[model samples]
Target: IRVTVTAIPIPMACSPAFEGKSIRKEEMYAEFGGGRSPAFELLRVRPEAEVEDGKVTVIGPEIETIPEGSAAPLGIVIEVAGKTMKKEYEPVLERRIHNFVNYGEGSWHVAQRDLIWVRLSKEAVKNGVRVEHIGKLLASKFRIDFPDLLDAVQVTLITDPEQVLTAKKEAEAIYDERDARIKGMKDDDADTFYSCTLCQTFAPDHVCVITPERPGLCGAISWLDGKIAYEISPAGANQPVQKGGLISAENGEFEGVNRFVRKASHGAIERCQLYNFMEYPMTACGCFEVIALVLPEVNGIMVVNREYKGETPSGMSFSTLAGTIGGGVQTPGFAGISKSYILSDRFLQAEGGIDRLVWMPSVLKEELASRLKERLKAQGKGDLFEKIADERNAETIEALTEFLAGVDHPALTMDSIL
Candidate 1:
């Protein structure tokens, strides 16, 4: 199909896409192509380009120059290989979900037109493209071209399309199948599991263990995924460590994960672990603020925030040096992070008891939130007890770091703290 598209920059356009007559960020979609090889071309436009009746009256920003920043707007022009058609269209919600499944998370944020784009044509609409089919097409046609996006791009064929009625149902089925085997496992209550240790580079001395019942503070990965990742690599993504036997006198004691923390931190952090969020404790989640550390020549301790783009206080990039401090192991790279695992025992701990918990993101946490809340309240601290909550992001990570830095409450560490 022969098509031309563009992205338009708009100051008052309000809506990000055609679907959002009001909100600029919303997107609208349509289908094209099913016939022989179709010719296609892409063009970019500015946000102010008039799209009133569907005919391109004015041009917007240049396709290549379309700024990646949030303030800029873009327009995509699609011309069929044979016909001229333009109309405001609403995309099914499933389309976005499929995007996530095939692309993992935040596919659009990092995606460029070269990765995927619309190929409008008369036959495309006639075929009535389904998200599953699109995902497969991406996987078969474009997945390899973007190797960095394969896992994130959850491309899968819908063997039985009829069963998919809603996005929620689709998500449920996918997760159910993935989590079926990990329904029951246990971690020592004192172990304090978490997946937010990845944030150590960004928010030092803060660890957020993701449990089967609770997601990470960043709301990124679910415990089930974490568990699977753990199974894939035991010593790599995260390592299980003892917490109870720690010899704590004030804040400078604790064994197991604590010793691991000191080594991981290169002796930068003095004493602390998941359970004791007090001074120089477990590192923050990957999505956190203020990375704390004990740098050579630096007096006392040094803290780095999300914006401290300069050399890290640890003499390592926050991204690379983070794994070394969080889960009792030192990881040199960030690519293996998504592959980290979660174990049943991490959440179903029975010894010492758990005080605080942390994790990434997952629906399983939502389903089991109430039960975890009850468990926390039963251990006293009912006044401090709220509910088993989940959070994920770069900003809230600072809060998590702060919490672990001072809170001495008995914590339950997870199997995959990193």
Candidate 2:
């Protein structure tokens, strides 16, 4: 139940008890990212010459100088050096920043990669927890959590508006490179899948089933990344799960996967359907990314990404849904997923694939347009693209049904959802 029980020199206590805690807008001293400003974090393997153990560098004004309750840009770059460190481990280690930051009694972090949203509490600021303390906290935990793989870990925190903007672009390139390393792979094409239990720091029984089509719900570790992580540290969180007999091809249940889930969840969970959201869906750790839930009013489903601050047809904001869905529990009618999973051929396979997709935020809709267009064309449902709605079209259950009917949306005519 304890994560990094070692002493960390910070104003507030550091423990797993605070891992998924939230800080409200009124309770926040300062906020960053979350669509308000550019923010990103990256971890890189560096030569010993480039790393200074325990160094925490804060660029721009410290957190104390920032105006209360204002959002700011942020960029965190961690340079690590060790005899065993490899580039393949960058994402695996970088994601720990989310865990370490949330460990702060007064700090809250969500999502991962460029879509991060972080908040420092008024109480923490009053207790002298500054921006530099965040770097110190991360530096200590990185070494503590991966002692065998990291010898030295130094951190750089950039908060200047323009600098953060520039640094985010640089970090994005690195993300693209990592994503490219495992392109054009398929789940069934291989004999085995991968697992990620790193988030077990907070959601102990949750195990991320990483396949080529479905990345971790946090949107950080892909199937290829999981494989590389296991190779780097065979005893680590990522492990290979051989694809045994198919229990249900429609719902994406494998004999080997069910066995692994039972063992990993300590017998707490016995069934997990990877491709179905309304029946035994995988447990959600609720770190970041997107959430899909059925809106039975119109016989369809809607997806809301972390950046979407407004309420969805499901009558909940992204944060509210995250709180309700996580804690290693399987909610049959909902699932936490990466943005890329929406484009996968297996998305909601048992409930009728992407055809059940009725609404999403416009920004996300546009973000996946080209690739989604190709997917729709391949599925012979290219016209369904225009039929899909967004917030501008409808934000409530009644409005969504009206809009779907007005547009003759396929979901309205499809099979029952519930």
Candidate 3:
């Protein structure tokens, strides 16, 4: 069924750009909630020229600009199929914040993706939306009409005075809930997982899948958000394909999983078999921060780094290929790894091994380091623990080259080691 939703801008609340310079009609890198970043265009604009006693009627595309260096702010009325409709707001902010981070000033992005539904059926109701809370979220409001006439709808709005605090608080609350749930999981429990998988386009070989019990290492999407996404589109941006059973080990290969991986990646990840330290095994995302290669002369392996900030072995920047990896199908058994996942050795090592993770966040590195120690203690390999936790230096463009230049362990560097 075709559904239409109207986006009404709340007065003096949502901001779209920095200073008075509004984003023109151009497609740019944007994200919605934790979904993969999508290209967003400036469909239209409505400007509010007058405000009396907090009541404003913003005409099409012209809100007064905030002072210099302030966020581009405004309210809007999004029309869909002529009727007032209910819609989701989280994705809008997610996309906007992502644009700001990658294109705008430093890392200040809005956080909340949860938007309460508003019904907009009649004209009066639709007009009331301009003053309602949902509109306030986007800095505009509306009521829905013919609520039963549609299945779903989402509208995006550009606001003035970006509502970062409200969104951040909501995002944090969701994260806290996720942390609580995962704390109750056993060491080796399998459950449905969620991730951005989109990020792989940029961080290939790095698979980041998050379960209800585990938060993503990047701390982006939460379990609650994942559940909402699944609800929104079971087959589109929201659903996850589950992994079942094990792969057979023949010639160090798992036929079932290997077949699945090849089919999913269209044969891009052909070498992925049953082992972790094997060459060209299925990378979570085509984009990898580092590629672990075995150097026969050194009797060890070295890592070719991607996503590093400095000079790489090939003198390429992380941004050069960050788009190749995270946004598509990953290993067969694993769901897409776009946004979040636990920082565990089992998950990390499944690709190549720890030597590749020198570039992850400090928090994740430390968490993994501590967890590895515990696991090592269990297996009595504690003496061999080298505490490879260098937040500032691990994944630098230089370090990745160094990893590939030196080798300490063959098994650790092999493309697949069952």
Specify the highest-lDDT model's number.
2
- Using TM-score as the measure, the top candidate is 2
The sequence of per-residue lDDT tens digits that candidate 2 reaches over residues 1-418 is: 4555558988888987788678988899999898898899999999999999999998898986898988888888999999978888899888889889988988888789999888999999999999898899999999888898899999999999989888888898898788767667888897789988888877889988889988888889999888888887799889998879999889999999989888988888898888887888899987748999988888999999988899898999888998899988888898999988888888989998888899999989998899899989988988988889999999988899899999898787788988
Q: Which pairs of residues collide in candidate 2?
A: none
Candidate order by TM-score, decreasing, is: 2, 3, 1
Model 3: per-residue lDDT, tens digit, 300-392? 333332222443233333334333333443333222222223233343444444333323334333534665566667656564344332334
Tell me how candidate 2 scores on lDDT: 0.88
Give the whole-model CA lDDT for all candidates, comma-separated. Answer: 0.31, 0.88, 0.34
Off by over 4 Å in 2: 1-5, 9-12, 16-27
**How far off is residue 234 in model 1, in Å?**
5.1
Better of 1 and 2 by TM-score: 2
> What would you estimate as the lDDT of candidate 1?
0.31
With candidate 2 superimposed using the best TM-score fit, by how many Å does residue 246's alpha carbon deviate from the native? Answer: 1.0
TM-score to native of every candidate shown: 0.33, 0.91, 0.43
Per-residue lDDT for 1-418 in model 1, tens only? 2222222121111111321111112231322111111111122111222222223321332222322221222222222111111111101111122232222111122111111222222232234432233333333322233233222222222212122123224444443443444344433333544343433432444444454543443333345445434453344334443444657533324466556566555676555433223234433433332233332221112233322233432455544544444434322212111111222222212212233233222333444445544544566545323322223221243444444344432332322222
